[model samples]
Target chain A: METSVLKSKLQSYRELALKGINHYVPKSEPRKHLYDLVMDYPSRGGKGFRPGLCISTCKAWGGNEETAINSATALELFHNAFLVHDDIEDGSEFRRNKPTMHEYNNIGIAINVGDAMNVLSIKPLMMNINILGPELTWQIFSEIEHMVRQSVEGQAMELGWRKENSKCLTEDDYLRMILKKTCWYTTIHPIRIGAIIGSKGKVNPDMFNRFGFFMGTAFQIQDDVLNLIADEKAYGKEIGGDILEGKRTLMLIDLIQKLKGSNKSKLINYLANCRNENQLDNASWVLDKMHEHGCIEYARKVSKHMAGAALKEFYTCFQNVEDSEDKDMIEALIMHMISRDY
Target chain B: METSVLKSKLQSYRELALKGINHYVPKSEPRKHLYDLVMDYPSRGGKGFRPGLCISTCKAWGGNEETAINSATALELFHNAFLVHDDIEDGSEFRRNKPTMHEYNNIGIAINVGDAMNVLSIKPLMMNINILGPELTWQIFSEIEHMVRQSVEGQAMELGWRKENSKCLTEDDYLRMILKKTCWYTTIHPIRIGAIIGSKGKVNPDMFNRFGFFMGTAFQIQDDVLNLIADEKAYGKEIGGDILEGKRTLMLIDLIQKLKGSNKSKLINYLANCRNENQLDNASWVLDKMHEHGCIEYARKVSKHMAGAALKEFYTCFQNVEDSEDKDMIEALIMHMISRDY
Candidate 1:
């Protein structure tokens, strides 16, 4: 359960998944604009959380690493694809310590690259048929179908909220949004898919839902917190980006609910301004208000509670499975969610 | 097939596919920005060439109407998704006589809606499980996977060409680009899928590839010609928009190849300018040159040749199959391709 051990385990799984991802990305023509850009975000080191969860859960459930590699690679590709489009949608400037795809290239090229990544991801899933048989492969496809639908629906909610600049969001709304947006693909489906592959589709995937929801939400909260507090170098994203984009993180929602009258109106007006405009002064003011109102501290406390629930659910979900290093890694992952710096 | 009869048959097929597409689009919350937008391009009353080809081929191969609906619907959804993103990428102002999605909504919302449409398309494919069983459904998924990959690669080629403003493009290059971009999804896979379903996977889908390529390229060439000459109201798109976008159509390439000295430099400069800039005089001048240099007539001649080849291919590909209305309709559709104004 030591931090170094978990980090190494995650690193190893990431390398394996990256290898699979690289193999799938066609190194043919149109290299400069298309295939090369498809490799950009994936090559920029992510924590590999999705792939780690999928491969580790599969290993923990008595499947060999090979059986899950294609699925794991597909998950990584999908994750990177989402990040590429998400960066464009959020108007993000930095990713993994580099200019975002849309910033480095033009928006059109970036969008097409994201689309190519989506198309490339399908190859790995199709490869799953040879290893997992048609029935299980089809099940994985269905799981992917649900994962994509939920993620988009969740994205629609958040994008809609920002467009409307809704100031009346609540904790429950935040939870539901993250569950659909962050949890389903990031945690729930990865775990369910890994387990399904590992257990040959015998294990009930529904059993992992609550565990993934709690774990994934906690991870997302911590990520939001890290965006505000972590070193810009370590975080690999611009600090206060969520604020600039007016993302309705739990802390922002809590701050909205707590503030009143003039201060609240000022915050609302600040958010209403175009993201392209200069809003540094207003952004810093909002951050200062968040600190003064204990929004950051409140979010951290809620994240810890979610992590605790994840731990409990993790035990129930994996109680019948035999213990192994992968299981230990997964447990360590849950514990590490609340403690990591980035 | 009489012109009116062909029109009615195409309309009926389009209606059937639209019904299937509507049944798949969820009527849930987040309707305005997400699900509603997902239906926007589909409901814009496209020609339904893809669905019609797919359904008719299926019926011609002795398959029932019910068996082909899901695949046809999925193809239409994919087509619409492509249009939504294509409008954004091309910076197009109008689509089907209305503002492009990105023009009506912001680019961010437009991109997300396109992503949602891509996600929604998967449902119908997955629904194929009970009806077609697992193996054939997997085959269809593989077809879709190839279709999408080819389409994106083709798009990347076109986008890259515009980005570089390359003037030395050849007829072969144009053919290669549209083969991947237009033929694969627009014609090849649809017919292949239909034949596969109709014959219960016994037919060779590859046999339709040349037929599709010839038919689809001819169809695209005529479309380009119509973009310049079709009645504004009947065409449902801005006349000369392709010139504004600096699209590397056959006529444009022909014009480039034929022009000399100052006129060539002038055309290159005109193309190098931003699409947002006013290029009315330059566009008209280029169109005038295309006429004087016989570029438009050259393209029309090429289209007729391709259409002739497609007709020959149609006979060869369908030689073994029994005579039916669907088969005759397909022949009429090919004949209609190089003839229609819209």
Candidate 2:
């Protein structure tokens, strides 16, 4: 399929998921401030990738929109809630081109807003009891349970690395961290959950594991790449912000491994001193070293390899399924995730 | 029941619930930091009032310890998680005489810990599926759903009042706020959840509504009074902490109503300026004013009246049930709650 066609198809799914989230997220009185902050992220909007993937996989597996919308919305709510906390933890200034929740509000209120959204997210999963019945609800709930644990574990790993200024990290270490942090919530659980809803609890959730891992890892590497290269407007966040936050990105790891002599100590000194956005000036030096070391090209090649592997795993997992536009979109998403500019 | 015996009875129930919580709260690696911070609040030791009421009421109505333990742990986990966030939100320093979670750790990590605990709390509640089965799990889930919403709504009310610095609050406004904030989770839902578990989904949850409201309100008033009058060692938190935080306690409301001229403006100035523990010196003046207006005395009268009503409602609800030690403990708890110094 052509790239634009696949892109349009994914955008439609994003729209559908947004509508479901809009319906599910509470907007009433009292703690309306909390709910309002929750809506802030989704309303400003990202790619809506999590819920889009969830709903698409559900539909591709023979479920209709109605059957999967609640769970899809739940996934999106959890994703946004994580972003709210992540921005605070990373000390990033912006998300989706606007002030992050903690920047717009105080850190205290921002934490409450994230906490409230986490609580509100549970509401939609409980709705599964009515839509899909107790047994399937448990399955979906268990998937979410595992997803949240893995994501937080991943987040903790990244935070711990930054906190200690650990310099001994390897590329393999980065992979393991993102696998827990990004892959599970980003691809694995969404696919697993969609299949559970689509198959009415009959799907082997384990089958999607390899496919999700490859695709989500590819997506993340591309994301890190874009953080360095993409225009700030196109990226919808501060360009080179990851370096400023001293994140253990693939490029950073590769740059550290490939550099020698004065470069190594300079990078270490830069990382040790740069705890927040104030060090953006030093960020470009790190970025230049990453580019000089072929870090960007290396990451791209690895992401492309992962995307190719994902396509193979996609076929193995979806071979028995019937053909549908949703199936096509899911397959095409692998290519889009790797090749997109934003 | 003598006060000592009643206290011992409640203590036993508290121990049972604590055992369940200790078993359920996650203690594994990777996210251990998050879970460790979670155990911080519960381990420092609260009165265990919520879980004690839950387990005892469940047993009194014919539920076994096995049937009620999970829900009881869940209530406690939720309560502790709330404390973690509430401390951050209210800028509170001491909890159970130790630094607040955000005070003990950085704000970012503390928020993550609270988020992780919120997620961990759900795991035990889901265990209800195995122990209590699907139908009743849904009932318990629904009860929790309402409890979380009410608690957040109530918290929002308190936070919003402080944010706006609105002095137009009446005693009725205070009651309405506490009804959502204090009464529902602390008293009403615990009893309602206990009855549901005991009756195996057969009991009417509403019968405990009035009983819980009066009991919880009285307990809160006593708690407020103890905050002022108890020894700092016995109080387990900073004395006069609530005044410094500008909490809209019943006593504060009463003091505001009774004061005239400069006294009113002075109290308002203290509230407007002192948002945190740094203003402890100013806190004593507000506390002194509360005494001068007979505010603490007035709050105690209202508390005694509420406790008397709670005892009456207790008889109306529990009279039909067969007598047991659990029932006796529930009966005696009213006296203990109203009369205790801490």
Model 1 chain B lDDT-worst window of ten: B273-282
- lDDT digits (tens) for residues B71-128 of candidate 2: 9888888888888888888777888878887786766677777777677777888989
Best TM-score among the predictions, by candidate number = 1
Where does candidate 2 chain A have its weakest 10-residue lDDT segment?
A: A29-38
lDDT of 1 by residue, B1-342 (tens): 997898888888888889998999988877987998888888889788999999999999999989999999999999999999998998888888889998988888889898888888889998988899877888899899999989999999999999989889999999999998899999999999999999999998999999999999999999999999899778888999999999999999999999999999999999999485999999999999999999999999999999999999999999988999999999999989999988
TM-score of chain B of each: 0.99, 0.96
lDDT per residue as tens, model 1, A1-342: 788988998998899989998999887987888999998999999898999999999999999899999999989999999999999999999999999999988888888898888888889988898899988988898899899889888998999999888888999999999999999999999999999999999999999999999999999999999999899998999999999899999999999999999998999899889475899889989999999999999999999999999999999999998999999999999979889987
- After superposing candidate 2 on the true structure, give the runs of residues whose Cα lies further than 4 Å from its correct spot: A260-262, B276-278
